[model samples]
Target: MRRVSVDIGGTFTDCFLAFDGSYVEAKALTTHNNLASGFMDALGNACEQVGKDVETVLSSVDAVRYATTLGTNALIEGTGPKVAILTTAGYESTVPLMRARGYGDGLSEAEQANLPAANRPTPLVPVTRIVGIRERVDYKGEAVLGIDETDVREQIRRLVDEGAQAFVVSLINSVVNPAHEKEVERIILDEFPTHLLGSIPIILGHRVAGRKGEYARTMSAVIDALLHDQMYHGMSSLEMALRKAGYKQPMLLVHNTSGMAQMNSTTSLQTIHSGPVAGLEATNYLSKAFDQPNLIATDMGGTSFDIGLVTADGVKFYDFNPILHRWLVSTPMTYLHTLGAGGGSIARFDRMWNAVEVGPGSAGSDPGPACYGRGGTRPTTTDANLVLGYLDEENYAGGTIKLSRRRAERAIQEHICKPSGMDLIDAAKAIKRKVDHNMAQAIFKEVAVKGYNPKNFVLLSYGGGGPLHACGYSDEIGISRILIPPFSCVFSALGAGNMNQLHIHETSLYMMLYDANLRQVLSDFTEFNRTVVELEAKGREDLRRQGVPDDAIRARVEVDMRYGNQLAQTGIVVPFRRMETAADVITLLDLFSANYATRFGEGSQAPEAGVRINVIRVVSYVEHEQLRLRPSEVRVGTKPVARAQRECHFPKVDGAVSTAVYDASAVAEGMTIDGPALVESPRTTFLVDPGWRLTMGAMGSAWLEKITK
Candidate 1:
């Protein structure tokens, strides 16, 4: 297969090209002003490596996939259009109130604990723009009061006159019944038809999120409406750029749900954190390819450090109500936690500890790090790495940019060293150690919370900064083995190439499998079976709309079930699509019990309280031919010649050590390099600390195994 995939991140844009039997990787600084410019620059770099022009390569490629942080950046930067909400009468405070817990959404545990410091995110739509209409729908899907057509028209016009750029109709209980919401949409369109200059896009709550929770569902629709124009224009510009380069195929977008779809089939909410999710998908592929079913994937890039888990048990983890930026929204997103720790993470002196503290703040791409000499005066992890002699000053990013050692020293001296009583080397060492500890703690918490042992999984480290600090963080987590995958710099892009086209459809309803209240079991299966089929049909139609054939499509069934009146619902993927017999219901309860016990603890199952299914979901996907990857083989004790030597400092070590440096492009497959050593590539560098050894493998793949505790 001849294909190209690209991942646009905060600091850089990475591209992966797979053709015939060759794979190429390329990188370029991200152009925030115009994402397409950075995208084409990275692709052009890959084309140059293969001796082809952009037009020639793009015209003949099978498919072009994109996994980007565009939507995420827009949300963080508040670059979306002003959105107005229309809801059931008397719920004017729904968006503003956002529930009591909404104030703590997207905040750290410490910040959440400090009540006086907690505050809700700035309102996406002000209360004045959130006029309510006379409409009501009960949880039973019964419309008790029809929406007044005149009321709907007047409210939409009032919002428009108040400078509303888009409209969101999110009446109460819309998930169970959308009649009131649909009527409001019809009224808005009639007042301002598509052909008129006052026309606006209308986003229905039920269509954006097919679940319950009035607050979460409404926020989902509001966020979708806010991001609609930004995503559409950004995506359109990218597509136009591709067309100018002679590409005729429709561009596919990677979604955070571990699926891919054409632009027409995607929603703005699905694109948040897509780049990181694509990296996790690559980890899933690596788990099978490397014959290691359990792995911890870590991507430490310029802006953030992301951690994701993939285990041997075929269980996929998803967050049904994940917080996007600061807004809590209801969407089924594949779970991946991000920490504001990376190369550009700024380091400051914390007076409380009399030591250094690394970031939840970053320098991003523009003005990058102090070492970049791009007007960045703040001391960052990148500056520390450069000061410690891990990065070559003249050869950084293949000489596309030069590093300034003097500037790095000046930043550290003025900020970290001056605040504390420490010298430059000690300050740099402290920054490295602190950042590594922060990442290790986050990984441990993510794994332990899931009831998995960090020691049981091998760490798969990628991104530009991952290999450089793999030994430091892996040792802290008690992990002895680290696999830096082939094309590590563009691993997420490679994963995007292997994704299947998929769509998910679901509905909220109350169904009892075992009623502890009545001491009875479910005797009727007709309603349960019908809901599953209806959800399946919706998913099938979605895939068919994207031109997928019936034979190529398949479906999976999942349901969110809980015990008693507990707010936590455990999602279970059922092996059987339709439950016919009483035994099938028992099987579902058993599945939920087992999964719950695994997540919480053994004997934590509360079937004695009651058993109920809150939501039913169907996943329809069309499997495409995946790009084949060969397993990497390692040879031990075959040492490669060194290119040079440099003096590097390390934490917990006495002083500067003479480190042997090797050019990554010149190393032979299966050659080994023992620490303390440095492996330098044009795009990234690998640091092998003392007590660790590096084993070279095929296709730029390598292993960093710790030799000592």
Candidate 2:
């Protein structure tokens, strides 16, 4: 079994190759101008390590899976074409108005609470470009008024005259009846043929989102249309490069829904935050492989720290209407909470507190951290790490790039130490403490908010900066055990390799499961069964289009249900696909009750008012053979010899401690190194702070267990 997977992040491109029984990992700085260059460089590095050429490796791999940030970058940089929205008459302000709570979407709680600092992001489609078509469709699948072709053409021409390069037809309630939206799309395509030079791409809300929210659906289509061009070209260039390197199979793209599918079968909206989601998926696989049923997955990279949860009951948490950046969109995304605290996050003195504060702002890859000698003048967490002697100046990233300790000292002394009136070592320690505190708070909130205790789950830390600081953050949250997974540097790419081919389809409808006021139960199962079958067919067709056989396809059903007059909906995955009897309806209600209780206490079940299912979702997938991971049985081992020594400063301790520096590549399974120690791998460094023991496990995995008193 040979496979290759790559994840393109903002700062680095990571690659993982599994050939027979050997697994290799590599990384390279990302080239934002041409992403394929970074992809090939990382892949070439891994191929060279395996004693194989790029052509031979590409030709021999079973699959080449990719999880890229192209869509995310496109949205962030605003490099997309101008898109115009066409909605029903009297709803021209729908996209511009957003929702009452749209301004707070994707913002931190502190930022959200600051009413005076509230500012909405610039609209992807301004009000001037939004045109209203003369059409109306009721909540039911009934047309109140048919759209006029002349009205549609004139409105479209007006938008094009006003500098609209793309179109989004998001008529109200299109999910219930999409006849008007389809008609508008047909007219636009007819007016501007695809073969012509002046043709523009058209997006329909019904196809992009299968739910019934007016603002969310429209924004989903708008985002899809906005990112279409950049994602297409970026993915195409990667594919062309793969072909040139002797690969003949279809390239699979990892999705934010915790699945993978052919490139042609994906939507741009489904690709946002895909790299982080892939890492979470890999954690899901590791949870089962290592027999740790509950795991908290944390990825600390150069720019961001992402956290996700894997529970013991096998309940997959999903955000059906998650916000993308500042726009609330209707899409099913694997739940992940991200904090802006990472290695390259800038540190500054807070005047209000008269203390050092770590980021929500990053130096990124262009100038990077001050230690990189890349003209970055700002103080960053990386600089603090360097000042504390946690990093090797001449051997960073396997010596691919050299660090400048003098520059790090200058940046920190000028920015943090001088402002806070503290010395250099104290300032660096303060910065480290603040950043770790921020991440610890975020992790605890993400877990506890879901009604789970942080102390019960084992911490699975990975990415470039994870293992280095895992001990600090884990201790703050009362977590005593941490597992640095195998291939920790490129864990997301490894996750991409384990994803199954899958697609999801859903529809919005009003179905009563239980009526408390009337004291009656749902008796008719025809509509429920029909809706399930239709959603299943749509998902099956999507998988079939990607060459998955009918026999190999499997589907899971989920319903978004809520109590009477409640705004929040709880998505419950049902055991059976089709509901043919009242027992099936009762079973769904019971499941929803249990899930809701788990999330909001056992006494919070609210079936007294009424219970209704608002949306029905179907996930169809074809399971592939996963990457086999070797299990670790050794928990204690012989002491390893140190290769060198370094004096490192700690946040909790005074002065400097002489730390044993060991070569991570030389250590075999069943070797233990007691802290304080430094295990330097090719791509990352593991800092074993005082009172923590590092135990080497199989396949480059290690355990960091704190010594209890």
Candidate 3:
């Protein structure tokens, strides 16, 4: 059972090695020059702990799962290949215009509300590169205008003349009928054969996403085509590296869907933020193991904070129109949210309230912080944390990157204290408090908006800066329980170990279950059953192609149900795999109504307007064995080992106080260290403030519980 999992993050590449029963975790600075170098370095560190060499580890391991941020970084760095888009003739402006609300797609509510400053992201596919062909298709897959082959050929030629390296064909309602898209691909192949380097790769809109949003579906295809070459080359090189190192099995890649797939089956969009999604998967495993039915997973890193939810009822949250690197895509990706509150987030003075404001701007790794001596002068959350005495100046990042207290003070005093007319300590305290409140509000909305109570969920904190500030934020939202799981630094890698091989297939259709406007309920069970079966068969075929046995395969049926012409669709997981009886149809309607009532408020149902299933999905999978870690029994003690003592200032307490600092390795299981203490590990620091106690648990896990007054 030897396996290695790696998560390549923005700041670090985390590695987790499972050698038989023992687990070892390691981290290394990410080197963008060659991602494999950083990956190997991190893996080497873990192997050293297990008394193994690189060749021995790679050759012996059953699998090596990777969940990386490469796609995210590539998108942010604008390193993808030049792409051209082709769509229906009338929809040339779709990508540039986006949806009227696309400006707010990936923004905070506050930023979205401030419409004056709102701006759409730069178009990935420019107007000059976007060419359209004559085509028209109705929502029901009926062709209104016949295929214009001559028009398609000319449009491809024009795009090629304009230097289109890639092509996307997104005809209206292609999800329902993809004949026009198929024809366009045929013409593209015939005009420019694959043997020529000039031959462009084409992506059909329906193949990437099975939904009916014209603009979103088109953008999905465009982004996929744009990133295909980059991801393919990157993944292929990695596979070759693994092969050279004596590894044989396919290099399984983790997807944001909470599933693992081979590189051949994964899309670039599926790989974005996969590292954080792995963290969420780890949280789900923890929830089940500890019997914590509801949990909120929070990963607070240097540049972003990710939040994911797991409910007791097993209600899967999905975004039908998710934004991928600023492009709204009609794909039902697993729902996760990222907030602009992290260690590198800049903190500024709020002139209006005479308070403090945290960031939408980050001092990323390149310029870093003023303390990093990279010439960054801006005051950031890290600067505030340093000013508040939470971080050790000489021991940050294992002392690999030294911090400058003077620089931190100057940055804060000049940028925040003087502007707000407050002392440095007060200004730092305000910044911390404001950021915590911001995160708490975001978590509240994430849960409450989905008709769940924040108070009912246990907060699972991970990442470099999570535990340091978990108490500050979770307490603000009235969340009492916090679990910092074992191998918190490599939690996402742990998630990669727990994933099942899965494939999802879906198709868009305009099927009315109940036409309330005309006062009619669908009695056509054959059509309904046929659609579900077709989707299931597609999913089954995908799994079968992946080498899954028929007997081992499992499937779940889901329908995107909506009332009237509403933009929002509620996905309902149907119990019946194939609807045969009227009673089954009635049961589905009841389930949908219940889910709708829970989400958008009761009595919001508009069945009188109409009821329809816009999309049908099937998730096929062969469940694999998982890695299980036992939870430690809670023990009470008041003894602590002190490595050193430092004069630290805490916002909850007045003035500077001498706080005890201990190495995490020194803390044994069942040992407890109380208030005003710092537990320093190689990968992260746990700052235990006054009124909270830290308990060491099994498998490097720790609990930060609030002490009663």
Candidate 4:
């Protein structure tokens, strides 16, 4: 298979190319102005490695898939179009009020606890522009109030006059019945026909999310509309670039659903955090490739630290209504956690702590860190590393950009040293410690909160900054094993290459699985089986449109069920797709109970009260042949070749230690390197801190572990 996958990040555009059996990785500075340029540049770099030009490479590849941070970037920059929302009458404030807890949606617990400082996200659509029409849909899809066409036309006119570039119609309970929403769209099109010069785009809520949450579904439509123009033009321009380069296959866009779909099947909201999701996909593949059952994937990049999990149990984790930036959206996204901690994470004096604090803020690539001498004056993690002699100033980013030691020292001294009354090195050490601990805490929470013990999982670290800090964070969280996977810099791209073409269709329903009041088991499988079949057919139609043979496509059924009226629902991947008998119903109940028991402890199952299935989901996917990362069976004591040596200062150590540095290029799969060393590559630096050892594996894979001897 010849495939190329690229992840457009805030700082770098990473490319992973698989030509036949050989793999190559490349990265270039992200060009926010024209993403295509950076994408081509990174691809060109990969082509050079494979001894082919861009035309030759593109013409030969079977598929070119891309994962991007563009949607999230646009949201953060607030550069999307002026979006207005249209909702059911009296539900005008649904988007504005944000469910009472909207202010704390995407924030950390501490930020959420500070009620005095609570504030909602900047409105996606101004309340004034959010004019409502008289329409209502009951939870059961019954239209209680008819859509007033005249009112809809008037509201659209008012919104257009009020400068609404795009429209979102999110009537309450529209997912159950979208007739009112569909009518509103038809009315909107009538008023602003395609022939009109001022014709605007419209987004319906039901088509965006099938779940039954008013505020979240509304935001999903709003965000999708807001990001439409940008994503459309950007994606179109990128595809054009690919076509121009002799690539004939349609470019596959990775979705946060942990799947890849052609541009025609993709959505703007699904593109958000896709890069990180692709990284998780790669972790999943690695988990299988290396036979590591439980693994914690950590991607520490220039602006964010993402954490995800992969276990051998085949139990998938999903965030049904996850907060994107500050707005909760009802998209069934693969469970992934991201923190604003990275190499460019700024460090400053925390008056409350009387010590340095690392970020939830970043410098990004533009004017990146003080060490880059790119007009950034703040002390950042990169600067701290530079000051501590971990980075090679002359060869950072393959010497694409020069680093200034003076700037790093000045930034840390002026900002961190004076404020914290610590020396420059000490302050840098403190910054490193704080950032590592912060990441460790996040990992612990993400794993333990889901009832998984941290010690049971091995740490799989990737990205430019991941290996640099993996040892520190792993040690803090009691994880003794860390694997820096192949092409760590472009690991997300690797994931994109391995992802299956998948589509997910789900619906919200309130069905009683066990009727406690009536004391009857759900014997009539008509409704339940019918819904599951419908969802499967929808997914099947999608894959069929994508040119997959019906036989090649597979479907996995899942039911979101809860005990009694509990808010938290347990997602059960139904072992049996259809329940035609009482025994089948019992089997599903047992499965849900066992899964729930494992998650919330054995005694937490209270199904004696009743059981209900809230949502039915069907995942139709076409699995692709994956890249295999075979483990080496070499002896562990193989001596490493010394490429160079450097004096590096580590935290809590009195003085600088003369550490042996190895050239990563010369390290073979069977080679092993000892502690207090640096594994230098052109694109990244692997810091093997004191009391650790690294065992090199195939495909640039390496393991950093605590030195027991």
Candidate 5:
């Protein structure tokens, strides 16, 4: 397969090219002003490695896939049109109140646990711009009160007069019955006709998400509308750039759902955190290729560290109601945990801890790390790494940007050393240790909270900065094996190339599989089967439009079940496609019970209280030819040669050690690299800490194992 996938990050743009089964990865500094320049530059680097030109590569590839942080960055920068929301009457505070926990929606656990210090995120729509529509719809799709079309038009006019650039119609129970929302859309369009007044995009809540929670669903539609213009224009520019370079196929976009779809089929909400999701996808493929399961995929980039999980049994994990930039939205995105611990994460002296603090703030590409000599004055993880002698000042990022050791020393001394009364090396050591501890704690909590043991999983580290600190954090978290997957630097981009054309359709409903009050089982399967069919049709239509045959499209069923009106919904995967008989219902109940037990505990299944299915989801996908990671015979006898020596400092390891630095490329497949050692690649560095060993594998995959006493 001839394909290309690019992941545009905060600090860099990564490109992964698959040219007739020969895979190559490349990276370029992100050009934020015009993203296409960065994309083309990264792609050009990849092309040059294989002796190909830009146009020739673009014109020949079957597809170009992108997993980008475009929407995330835009949302963070608040770069979007003014949004006006039209919610149901008496529901004006729904989005504002944020389900009473708006204060800590996207915050860390420590922040969430503090109630007095809680504060809501800045409103996406001003209270004055949010007008209520006089309409009512019950949960079961029954309209109790009629919608006022004249009233909607008047309210819309009021909001438009208030400088509303876009509109969001999110009525109560809109997912159950979208009649009121549809009417509002029609009235808005009539009032602002596209032919005369120009096209004005009006977002309807029911179309964005098929969930019942009004607040989450409303935010989903609002976010979708907010990101619509930015995502469209940005992605459109990229597509046009690709087209100019001779690419004719539709540019596929990776979704936060861990699925890839054509731009025509993507929603702005689905594009959030897509880069991290793609990295998880690549982790999944590697897990299968390398026959390793229960892996933790960790990506330590310049600005952030993202962690994702892949269970041994291949059960996909998803965040049904994930938060994006501090706003909760109803979207079933692939589950990923991101921390502000990266090379560019700012390090500071913490008065409280009397030590060091890593970030929730980053020094992005503009004035990167202080060591980059970009005029940054703050101490950062990169500066600490540089001061510790782990990084080659002259060869960082393949020498694209030269590092200033003096700048690093100055930043650390001023910000950390002087304030804490510690020496420069000591302060740098504290920074590294603190950041590693923070990451370990984050990973531990993430795994533990999900009812899994972190010790049971292998650490699959990628990204440019991951291998540098893999040993530090993994040791702290009680992990031993670290598999830096093939093309580790551009791993997320590689994951994008493996995605299939996919779509997900779902509906929120109150389904009682077993009514404890009546002591009767839900034996009749008419409604259950009908809902599944409806969802399947929607997904089928989506795939069919994308040129997939009905026979080629496959579907998976998922039901969000809970016990006794519990707010927590456990998504249970239905093994069978659809319920046909009484036996199928039993199968679903057993599946839900087992899933509940696995997540909570053996004694936590309270099916006797009641079994309710709140949501039904159907995933439709057409598989593509994946880039197979062909295995290499495990040859462990090859010896590696050292290229140079460096005096590097390791935290908790007392004195500076003279570490043998090896040319990463010189290490043949299956060669063993012993510690204390450093393997230097143009794009990244692999640190073999004391008591750990590294082995090179096929397609640039490496294994780092602990040497136990």
Candidate 6:
């Protein structure tokens, strides 16, 4: 039961150690040098908390699970190897053209709506590196034209000559039939040969993504090939480090799929944002643990706010065509949205609304905020928080990063107030209100768009900035209950510790379950069962390769069903592994209809057009025992303890008021702190606005309830 989980974030590296029953959590400033150094440092901190040494903990632990943002940082920094793409001849322009809507793939609605100013992100594979081959395949995998082997060899040679360190082979409808892609790889290997140092790494698009969108599928392959080397070497070094430390078990890496896998079974793309995905996994676990069915998990950090949902119905949401870096990819990543709003988000005057605008632009750790004395002139959300008296200047980030009230005021006044012709206090208030409203709107849209009510869900706030502003945004959306979970700073790391070993495999097919034009339904289960079997076999082999016992593994079959030729695919976890009768087809349709109705609204079902299963997915896993945390019971008659007092301004109040400040460590369990108070922890600050109160719970967890007058 000894295990260690770590989450490498942009600002900090969080570690959670589960030593038998006792859990210890610690954090350290992330050093970008060799990430392992920071990881070791964070783990050392956690071990120290348990009165143990790093070697003792590492050697004794059965497993160490890591959920890192390294892939995300690499994408943002464009630090991967140069890649070359070879696709079907006619589709060479697809990646650059970007589906016409790809420009908005990872942007906010407002940013998307402003089309004229929109610019596509730089291509992961430049046009010069993209070459096409003469090959054609129909949607059904029927070869329309033979794959010209000579043409494939020529394209490979040209790309290699043009300095293509890696190759991505993405042919049309390759998921239906990968003959052409396989042939291209064969030729590449034949020409370069594995024995030679000139052998180029090749990634097949169909193998990477089992879905239809050629552009997205190709991009997935491109990114995978691009980042493959870096991820492999980095993980290998980490594994070696663990091995050297005397750990025998494989280093389990957390995947974004709410699962974990040994290094050998994971792809570079599967690990992107695994940290936040692990946070969602924690939410899922928490929901079952506390019997809280509906929950919205929010992680608000320095530069971004992430939202993930867990419903009472056990319905899972997935994005089949998720954008990684700048490339849209047909990969079923866990459904999560990142809003460009956080503590370091820049706050500026919005002339259009004559209000304020919080950013998609961020003052990252480099210049940070003006209060950090990092030469940042523009005022940010953090500055606004400081000016509003929400954060204690002397105790920010465990007082490691000291804040200057004068700097915050000057930055807000000169950049926001002077420009907007408002006073500093008013400007700060406006910034706070605007940022809260923006976050509220985002949460509202994210949930409402999926056919759920934000009011019905309990908000779980984590991350450094989450609790500080949870009440502000959640209150606007009628979310009265907010729970700051135990070990909030290391929540994601805790999540990584509770995951099962899993592998997902899927394949794209053009199978129409209900052919509206023919007025007939598919009666034969052979094709469907065959595809499911193949995918399951692939997943099983992955786990088997990782040394999982055959009897211990389980599989879940899901089909991405859609009505007609619509873009939206509603994934349905099939009740039975095989569809034996026409009645089973009807059952799937009924389920899809109900789920689709719930999401897109009733009467939105367009079954008259047709019914089809675009992709069949199989999730194979071996369940493991989880480290459970006990929730504290609600206690009455709790009172607040004030450690200090300060004059602070709140937007809800008219003028400056004397606010009580409490050291988070000194706050006893069951104690309640009334509004207009600041709770300072080493990791984060909790600002109890006027009309709200904070109740301290066990394990450093707290609850903030708004007082409705």
Which pairs in model 1 have colliding backbones? none
- Report lDDT (Cα) of residue 569, candidate 4: 92
How much lDDT does candidate 3 score?
Answer: 0.83
Taking all chains together, each candidate's TM-score versus the true structure is: 0.98, 0.98, 0.93, 0.97, 0.98, 0.93
Q: How would you encode candidate 4's per-residue C-alpha lDDT over 122-196 as one tens digit per residue?
A: 887888888878888787789888988888888888888899889898888888778888888898888889798
lDDT (0 to 1) per candidate? 0.90, 0.91, 0.83, 0.88, 0.89, 0.85
What's model 6's lDDT at 527? 93
RMSD to the true structure for each prediction, in A, is: 1.3, 1.3, 2.5, 1.6, 1.4, 2.5
Give lDDT: candidate 3, residue 1. Answer: 74
Candidate 4 clashes between residue pairs 3 or more apart in a chain or in different chains: none
Total backbone clashes of candidate 3, pairs 3 or more residues apart or in separate chains: 0
Of candidates 6 and 1, the better by lDDT: 1
Local distance difference test, candidate 6: 0.85
Candidate 3 segments whose C-alpha is farther than 4 A from its true place = 100-104, 114-117, 350-355, 373-377, 398-407, 410-414, 417-424, 517-521, 634-638
Quick one: ranking by lDDT, best first?
Answer: 2, 1, 5, 4, 6, 3
Instruction: State, as a TM-score between 0 and 1, how close model 5 is to the true structure.
Output: 0.98
Top lDDT hit: 2
Model 1: per-residue Cα lDDT at residue 238: 97
- Clash numbers, per candidate: 0, 0, 0, 0, 0, 0
Query: Candidate 5, overall lDDT?
Result: 0.89
* Clash pairs detected, candidate 2: none
- Residue 333 CA displacement from its true place in model 2, Å: 0.3
After superposition, the stretches of candidate 5 with alpha carbons farther than 4 Å from their true spots are: 196-198
Task: Return the clash pairs for model 6, or none.
Answer: none
Candidate 6 Cα outliers beyond 4 Å, as residue runs? 100-104, 114-117, 136-138, 142-147, 240-248, 350-354, 374-377, 516-520
Q: Give one digit per residue, the lDDT tens place, for model 3 in 1-709.
A: 7889998876678898999898888887676667888888888889999998888899999789999877887877677777888888888888777767777776656787896798878778779988878888887789998778898888888887888888888888888788988988888999989998757788888888887778888887877777788788888888888888788887888988888887777888788878888889898889888778898999987778889999988887777777775667777678898878888888888788877899767785657776777788998888888888788888887677789989988998999888888998988888888888889988998888788889888888988888888988987898776888898877888889888887777887678888886777777788677877877787777667777789998988888889878988889998978877768767878898988888888898888878888888888887877888778877757576799998777767788988899998989888998878988987788888777888888887888887854
* Model 3: per-residue Cα lDDT at residue 16: 89
